[model samples]
Target: MPRLKKTVFFAALITFATLLSIFCKMENRSNAELVKTDFDQQLASFQDAIEKKLLKAVLQRNEKEIKQSFLQTRAKYKRLEYYIEYFFPSTSALLNGAPIDEIELGENLIEQPTGFQVMEGIIYEQPTKENRAELLNEVKKMQLNLQRMSRFNEQYQITDAQLFDAMRLEIFRITSLGITGFDTPDALQSIPETASALRGIADVIAIYEPASTDKTVSSAIAYLDKQPNFNNFDRLTFITDYLDPISKYISSLRLARKIPTVASGSALHDDAISMFQTNAFNVDKFVGNSTQFINNDKVALGKALFNDAVLSNGANRSCTSCHHQSLAFTDGLSKATGISKGEPLLRNTPTLTYAGLQRGFFYDLKAGTLEDQALDVVHQKQEMNGSLTQAAAKINSSKTYFSLFQKAYEDKSGKADAWKIQHALASYIRSLAPFNSRFDRYMRGDKKQLNADEKKGFNLFMGKAKCGSCHFAPLFNGTQAPLFSKSEAEVLGVPSTTDTIKPKIDQDLGRYALYAYPQYKYSFKTSTLRNIKKTAPYMHNGVYKNLTQVMDFYNRGGGIGLGIPVENQTLSADRLNLSKLEIEQIIAFLGTLDDLP
Candidate 1:
């Protein structure tokens, strides 16, 4: 009788535990549903506001009304940016992408950008009938795009993991793109938009942790609201004291909620505490999956091969001949010297510092991988003029190389092979990305590393100077942040020489040689400005002798402002109107980017 009573009691206890588990799961599901429903409603409201206010203002030629309506629409769009950008990026591009021509590389198709940026360019200009017609067309497109986005929200289900992931990325976007005035070049309304973006994230946070108030996010929003001026905004303080802390808080909240991070194969790792942290990026994501596992053995082998003259045709020159480690892996020459005496290479030798972080390798962005780049250089007549397969045979004959290969591959019969050589060399390049520059240290809480001038320079670079728009923070490279999937090429209309008058464009066709696309003309891959202090004679053609000349060129608005006839100049032609002192300050900031040895 006692046993029977015990069995009944135990069974009842088990049943109660299971019911509690189900209830907890159901509650979590309900939270996700609630968040999604709120987002959907917000998106619908944003679309309606645009259709009624912005579209009407454009039609009536009311400039004042148009600007006001656009600003309101921008705030609403920012609220939905996190989900829309993550879930429906293609649609998001149509609604609010950069006002540039996006070319589908393989398909050879051009996608003309149409969105808020396009509308801003038109509205900020004279309110002519032709401009109104163009603005009207973009407004109608946005209306349809928003409608299509609404349909996706209705059908698509959201998960707790995705919601958290999207929010974190949005935080990154605000720091990298939003505050930098990347999307609001003409409008300059990024500060308020950033506040709206934070509010959206705050709303979702409230749903998950209702009892806990996010003081960090609230503080940031308050600061932004109080000082909304673009030029006077303290971006450095905002990033360090507020945005970074808010991101960390969100990460902590997600952890406390026991939400799993979605496995997104982005350059920015999911486990990164802050975007400015050393381990924030995953260099492996930039390479092929097969070669991602880089060990010390591979790096050692690569280092040796990089210095050995045996890899060259006549066993005379190696990579170090052009790429000097003391000079940030760059030769202090206007152009790289060829293997044959007096025969120079077509382009300048770019620094190999942090080279592996990019999707594209060369100036023209013709090579997809570092391994491919290594192979190309080895086979090029002007460079190495040595076959990797042949080089492998040479290495195989050497007993020293045989042992190194055996240990690297963990195979008894391991021999030097072409693919292994390429991987090893690429591995060495990847290991070069040591995120330990003075600027990096400053960003990671070492406040004393940067002085007042450097700080102001950083603000200018990120804000008024428009340098951060291309040279993104953390990496300071062309790889767009929050995604870091693609490398951008810009047509700067680089002159052949430093001639202020009659500035003739460099004859090099750049990417146009590879694709023949009109848009690709004069387009060179945006190189990393991390070690800009050491890598002198800037530009693909090595046109500028010093950073001062480069600054002057940009200040005057690139080649076009110098009277160069460039129809497809990607750089803004309008003068930066920077004072000499401001230019000096920017240079001082660039000096801080040199990596620590």
Candidate 2:
């Protein structure tokens, strides 16, 4: 009887414990759902406010009202940028991408710029009665975008892991785009907008992991609040001290919670606390799995092939003939002499310093990759003038070349081919990525790296000067922020010479020769500004002889500002009106981009 009673009591206790466990799990799930619902409600509220303001601004056609409302809408978007950018990237870009339109070589349709940026440009450019109709249309597009986002939120589930990852990526976005003023170029409200975005992240984090909220989060907010005027704010200090620490803390919390990220491959690693961290930019980020053949042996073989004149038809010119390391990989000429040694080449020789990081190659962006670029250069009539077949046969005839190719390709069979040679050359070129510029060192918390003038120059570059809008941060190239996937081409309308009195637009036609599109009439790939001092004779035609001349051209607003009749100049025709001192400051900042030892 006693044994039976004891067993019955123990069974009852076990049953109660199991029921309690189930109930707790049910409660936790309900809480999660509630949190998600609350977040959705907040997003809906913000979107509704934006819609209301946009409609009001469109109807009134008041420029001041429109600008104010647009800024409000952008702030709200920034608040939810992390969530929307992660889940609905396409829709998000449609809502607020840059005002530039992009079209590929063979694509029939152009990826026209739509959204806030478009509207911003239209309204900010003149804000007159002429743009009222266009502004209204843009507002309608934004409304549709809001609807799309709402639908996405309604259907998609938000996981804790995703939230964590989204927050980290948001931190990266703030570092790359927010601080650099890439998005809000016209108004220069990056500093304030960044604070709002950070607050949004904190709010979301608090909802997901209430107990994990710590002093670091509040400290970041406080630091942002304490920032000075946009021009005077020390971006280097803010990023290194507050932002980096906050990012590290958040990453630590995520790891401690054992949260599984939704997508680990593309997401920022925990060690990447700041944009200037040694491992911040992945060397292989641009190189996809399909074409990653870089190794020491291959690079060695590539170096040999690059210097060898056997690849050229005349055996008198090599890759190094035009791209010498001493001159920052450029031939230091207005235009390079071809192997024929007849007339100058059509376009200027671009530097190979950061060429590997760029998606599109050459001034016209004809080649899609470094490999394609190498082959094209070798086979071009005016360039190497060498057929791949002939070059390959010549190389295979030599025992040393055959052995080097085998070692490079990891083929014991000892074969030499055109593809392998191109790959080797491309590998050598790609190995020239220089990330150790003085600017890089400064960003990595080395205060002594930049003097007061250089720091001020950096601020101007990112702010009022509007250089960062195109050059971008970190790489300081057209490789777009956060992802750094594709390079951007701009129709700057470069002239034939620096004769501002009688400037004539260069007749190259740039990418138009390939695409035959009017929009691509004067389009040229935006090259890396790295080592600009060394790679002078600026522009696609190398028209500007010095940096000062180039700055003067830009200050006057490219070819259009020089009174050259270029209808589709992508660069704004309005003069930058930069003072001589400001120009000097900018040059000082640019000097820090030199990566030479």
Candidate 3:
């Protein structure tokens, strides 16, 4: 009896020891560390595939094999992009940024394009001997980029907060940029790539999520699985039912876990909230040198100058002459009139509200900053028709203006010069950022703010209507969501008139006139949809008189569907085929964007 009791005691002790050891091991390997390990392995595999498959296919001049390899390479990259893009932005840009020359901020140096997009443009087109050399060079560059990312993954440490933030932003990125075919413009593989990206995110989330959250992940995958093709994909249903819910669940988990905000200098900052969140977007993010321009005194002085007719050459019209506050800062004319009656301006007067959020200014995107934009408007031939130099002199001529300028620029050593005048005007415009709209309020947890029809409209705008893909969320502007780094321009192929008879592509050669890029022909800066209800006579040319007309044009697939010859139309020629009810719902949502008094 004594020997049997001793044996039982020893056996129980051994079992306890083994269980404790396993617990210790599990505790040591955190979810974040495990996620990193998984990410590293995927990235390494992608790099290997690129070298073995992509490089060889390109060099051998095997078009069929090259296409197949490129698809695989792109898919692998998309899977890892959620982490890579957030942690190492410059490398990601080198790997997959648009094949266009982009001027660096502050430095004003233009960066020549490289990587996947550059290669896509080359390999997808008819490959010539000359193009083959370019393709080889681009492939080598991509290999180098991959090596850089691999090195970054080795040293970079990711926290739980960053992982959650990255996952959410990835959803936003896929929703806004991915499904819209923004990156894979030629291949049109956005749908498949998006599915791959979502799966990648799901795999990572599954590592940490509890059993209760499993349904969210499964539902998202189910939605993606149900889609027969890219065209048939119900974007609205996916956003409303799956993506948004999953994001919310993850966000809740993040909060419940008490995870810290993402570290600064990463792709997303701690303050960077999702687009769906109300009162979260900071307008100062868009304001270049915000500290220099965001002063209250500056805004006040700018408001005074905005209403001062002396800013115009004839002194008969101020900024308010074309932009009335009553009409949501729009003139309500088809095209703005010059100081001299009967003389029309170059384009319709776009609203000042949320205009400052855009990276580029004007229909042609000629102005790089709001200060430059203000200067251009001041000196335009038929608009303000006043030089900044003359405007400064005129402002100084008045005692009231002199005192206001003195107050506004009190911190500056120099007097109110043309530069200060431009800055002040830009400051006032920047203050009009869209943060207090009905939609914004609703998003901030006011459940009763949006009605059933309005909510449906919101879904349609984001989903089937394809508006959110271009307009984007939160700001509902061209400034890309998650990171409002740059605004985008689209070639909608808008016609001169809504006339069905002998429809003609507008003669205005939009951004093409500015930079002369073949791709930019008929391309106009994507403007804000905020206050669309009030800002009538839409489009740069003001061809569409109402929202219904505009919706119908988009439903019919812009100029291409109208039987107009627009070879360079950036908007997809695929008809949206939205019903009347859907169109009305979208319009109702647009109404919610209007700022309350």
| Tens digit per residue, CA lDDT, model 1, 392-508 | 988888888888888887869769888999998998998998888888899899999999999999999988888898888777889888889888889998999887876799999
- Rank ordering of all candidates by lDDT, starting from the highest: 1, 3, 2
Each candidate's lDDT (Cα)?
A: 0.89, 0.79, 0.80
Cα lDDT tens digits for candidate 3, 1-597:
699998999999999999999889877988898899888888889988888998899889999988899989999999988888888888888999877776554674678888888888887889899998898898898888888778867887778888887887887787667776667766767777877888788778778773454678677776676773655566655765677777777777778778776643322335444556554555565566645547788899999989988788878878998899988899898999986778887799999998877788888878888989888888887887888887777666677777787788774333567888888999899888757888877766676788878988876676566777788776777878667787888888899988877788998899888666676789898899999999999999898899999999999988998889888786868788899998998899899999888
Better of 2 and 3 by TM-score: 2
Superposed by TM-score, candidate 2 places the C-alpha of residue 564 at a distance from the truth, in angstroms, of: 2.3
Q: What clash pairs does model 3 have?
A: none
As for candidate 1, its clashing pairs are none
Rank candidates by TM-score, best first. Answer: 1, 2, 3
Output the better candidate (1/3) by lDDT.
1
Off by over 4 Å in 3: 1-34, 47-76, 90-148, 151-165, 178-269, 393-403, 412-415, 451-453
Question: In terms of TM-score, which candidate is strongest?
Answer: 1
